[model samples]
Target chain A: MMTLLFILFATSMWLGWHGKRKPAIFVFLVTIALCAFWFKHHATSELHIDL
Target chain B: MTPTFARKLNVIFLIMICIPLIGAYTIQFGRGEFPCPLCLLQRLAMLGIACGAMMNVRYGIRASHYGMCMISAVLGACISTRQILLHIVPEPGNTGYGSAVMGMHLYTWALLIFIATILILGVVFLFDSQFESKEATSKTRSVPALGAVAFWLAFGITVANVCTTFLECGFKQCPENPTSYLML
Candidate 1:
């Protein structure tokens, strides 16, 4: 999961540096979506823990 | 907006980020309260954005804008990650010290506000292109250098505090239960 996040983050950083606004935004949005999905899945399962 | 107006807006943004941080600290030290994992993440994110905004205001928009956006994006990711972590892994072993607030209801509100602020900043950065203006860009490079220094200083102090708190009370000594409500 961390690796996926790092990849997304690195992609966004690359897009930003290259002045590719749309791609950067897309990457950020994708990161947010993945995070939300994982969070929901974790929250519903028995292993889910709230801090 | 004129350069002057942009500068003012940058300052305003910085203050927006700082006020809550100071309030959070007061609540933590003065009120003897501790923040949870999500809360700590939010504080860290806010600090990053505040530093970026402060530098933009002090220098110029062109130099600091990309850096600010990057910082905002990083912060947004951190806060979002913390929230997900809390919801998915609520066990004692997964928790960190000073990650849970001991008393008062306002901390939750603060957390929500902090998260929203980071997200908004990230979105703003996504659409902003003013920083790329050739004339303004050259004048703004120095801003980020100074901002980076300040960011490290603030981050250093925050880490030191967290370290001290962790040493004083291991994770086992802190609250095991999660907050009953979700701020988001």
Candidate 2:
């Protein structure tokens, strides 16, 4: 899950750097969605601690 | 560099400012070293400055310089005042707030950098001076922007790596049997 977040973050950052603002924004939103999903699922289940 | 090029440079400057701040978090969380009050204060100031710089890049040079200076001033004053107090008192009982209340290492290098940042922002704010005004026209601004961006990019990536390390380590405590240093 963390890895996925990192990948998404990297993708968004790359998109932003490459001057694709719309895609970058989309990627950023996707990253946030992934993070939320991860938090709701694996974060608590794996870490056993509320983040 | 061209004016458009300079605007891009401003973005880089913002990235540079993010580096150390991220490093400090890494040092604290990754290394299990807790941040003292002054350290936290400095971090807060740096965060504000970084955000301001990012905003400036998102907007323009004039906006970035002014916004950064304003935010830096607030954080700088808080950290600087704390440092001055630490230097004067240098007693655990004299400290205020969290670990600061217990007193911790002064981290003079960090303080120095904070001071330097304040000074740099001051100069940036004064960019309206005759010399700076001449430089602000289309062509000259690009060089500074480019330099600023390069600096920020290097700084940001370095610090972000540190932050990543901290997230991995996931520790919340300062070192046991910690050493306390006098501020002076």
Candidate 3:
């Protein structure tokens, strides 16, 4: 998961560096999607552990 | 935007990312405190914000870049709030997972950073008065050498985090309550 995150960050970095506005925005949205997925995957288990 | 104001915003974004990263490493290496799964997620969110800031610094100030910061901050805040709620009313002698700093846990600090990020972005959006000229939009001011330094700093931190996270979790899920550094 961390690897995937890093890949996204690096891709975003590259896209933004080249002034590719639309692709950069796309990457950022993908990041948010990944965040949501990871949060849901972990949060449920954490809730079970804590409660 | 005026070049001066844009520069200031870039610096602010850099500092916003740097401080939390430095603290995170200090707590991890200095105190031998391993981050749990949620803590790792919060760190990722921080990196996400830094990436957005780096974009603004390296490319040019854009609303979309700040939007990246806002989205990541929201994710981070949610993660920290959940962790805080988990231990709000702990059992006897639980004493929480990681050590507290300045009378508050690290998660609390992360929560504060996330909130601050949101507020700062809000203000930036409200008073976007720096963007006052067509020239400012057409020929955006390039980042100075120092901005390159800031960009590298964020990149290095992100890489370090990736390494540490891989060590902690590899391809499998990280444990909720980690007891020690998992180096496999």
Candidate 4:
């Protein structure tokens, strides 16, 4: 899962470097969404530190 | 705040962002401690922040590009804040997730950096002169030598992270407290 995030970032950079700015931004957004999804679990996990 | 100088500053800014990532690597390899899932996510946000500055350097500087950075910093702060909170209440002998550096956990430091990114971007945004001349698009403009070098440096780190993360997490979810590279 973590690998996927960086892969998206690489794709975005490649796209941006090649002059595909719009798609690069889109790919970046996707990676951010994926990161957030993974983070949601960690955030909501029952931590011993309540709230 | 001409676009030319802004590009140079962005290059320097990109290099600055990579420093923490390198620091994380040193801690990972030097201290033999692996980053947890949350720690990995903070790196993602940092790289995302770098990506915005990278866009500014590669293409002509644009407000949208800076917007990209501010959004990333905001999300990163959320992740870092949550991680800090998770450990703040503390449990017996738990101490925290990873080893401390300079008396503060990495996540705490991450939150600080995210806030700094947002603040820096906010101030940079004030220099409206940098956003002039939208006609100077990526095709018309060539990045300066330093800009290209910094761009590659940040991109290289992201690519390197891709390889390291694959080895660490494999196709499976990362372990809560990673001790060794999973694929290795």
Candidate 5:
């Protein structure tokens, strides 16, 4: 899963370098979505802080 | 600052960003301390932050690119903050996870770096000169060689990460507290 995320980053860079701005940005957005997912997944431990 | 100089600064920024990743790598291998899952996420966010600057270098200085970078930094800050809170009150003699530099763990330093990146990018946005037409800006931004190197360095590290991460975790989830490379 972690490796796949890094691959997406590399693909985004490759697409951007080749001048495919739209596709690069598109992949970047996907990257962002996945990052949010991973963050949620890993931060599952309950925080004990009070409001 | 001129658009060209801004691009140069973006290049320089990319180089600066690589420092922490390099340090992380050194510690991972040198100290034989594997990165936990949260550590990998922090690294991922760092790469995401780099992607924004990378877009500026490749396409031109667009606010959206910096926006992307800041977005990543925000995510990174949250992740680091999570780790810090988890270890906020470690058991007696626990200190914290991994090694400490300057009396703080890497995640604490990561939090600082993320905040700094956001603030620095925000300040850079004030120039408002780099947002000119994309074509005109790209045409004027002729010093692509250095910018290209910086972009590739970050990109190359990402690629290297893919390899190392696979070695460390394979297709399974990375260990919560990794002690050794899983595949090795």
Candidate 6:
């Protein structure tokens, strides 16, 4: 799941580099979607005990 | 007020972000220490900041661009702060997860960077000199050669992270306290 986030960031950077303004913004939005998912996942999940 | 100065600042911060990311890669690959999920999230935030700064460098300065940087910094800070609080045990001997850098844990360093980013953003906003003016509207802005290099460097780092993360997690939840590469 985290791998997907980095991929989105890379894509956004590449698009921004090429002056694809709107597409870069869209890519960032996708990255934000992943962020929201992760935040929810972490907040709701219980920490597993090692013992 | 000059666009050139704004562009230069963006490039400078972009390079600044690259430095820490390089160190992170070195620690991960060179020292063979894998980053946990939260650490990876911090990396994502840093890369996101670089992306915004790179956009400012590539294009002319825009308020929305700085907004992007601000958003990323806040998110990074939240993640790092959460990690820090999790390890704040009453017990005296708890060293927390992962190794420390220069006597401070890496997540602590990440929190510092995020705070620094907010401070920098605040300072940059106070000037407002970078905003495009009516008279300066006639001027044309071109992306600097160095900015292009920084962009590619950031992109490469992000891609490398993607590869490393995929190897570690493989479409599964990354270990909370990752010690070794799952694929390894």
Query: In order of the candidates, what TM-score does chain B achieve?
Result: 0.54, 0.52, 0.89, 0.95, 0.93, 0.91
What is each predicted model's overall lDDT from 0 to 1?
Answer: 0.49, 0.46, 0.76, 0.87, 0.85, 0.81
Alpha carbon lDDT at B55, candidate 3? 67
State TM-scores per candidate. Answer: 0.47, 0.44, 0.87, 0.95, 0.94, 0.89
Candidate 1 Cα outliers beyond 4 Å, as residue runs: A1-51, B63-107, B118-135, B139-184
TM-score of chain B of 6: 0.91
Ordered list by DockQ, greatest first = 4, 5, 6, 3, 1, 2
Model 4 error, position B22 (Å): 0.4
- Candidate 1 vs 4: which has more DockQ: 4
| iRMS per model in Å | 10.1, 11.7, 3.1, 1.8, 2.2, 3.9
For model 4, the stretches where C-alpha displacement exceeds 4 angstroms are A47-51, B138-140
Q: Alpha carbon lDDT of residue B177, candidate 1?
A: 36
What local lDDT does model 2 show for residue B137?
Answer: 27
Docking class of 4: medium
How big is the RMSD of model 5?
1.8
lDDT of 1 by residue, A1-51 (tens): 422443454455345334454565576556656644543443332434443
Per-residue lDDT, model 2, residue B46, is 53
Name the lDDT of candidate 6: 0.81
B84-151: candidate 4 lDDT, tens digit per residue: 87788777987888888999999898999999999898899889888955667645258788888887
Residue range B1-184, candidate 1, lDDT tens digits: 4665565566566555556666676867676555544454455445445545544554466644545445554545555454544444346675433344454234344546656765665565554543546555433343344344444444444454455335433443222333321211
Enumerate clash totals for all models, in the order shown.
7, 6, 1, 0, 0, 0
Q: What TM value does model 5 have?
A: 0.94
DockQ of each: 0.07, 0.04, 0.44, 0.67, 0.66, 0.45
Could you give candidate 2's per-residue lDDT for residues B1-184 as a string of tens digits?
3435445545555665666666665665565665543454355445445444443343345543444435554544555554554455446664432333114433454556566767766665554431224234223122355544644563455345335434442333222223332221
Pairs in clash, predicted candidate 5: none
lDDT of 1 at A47: 30
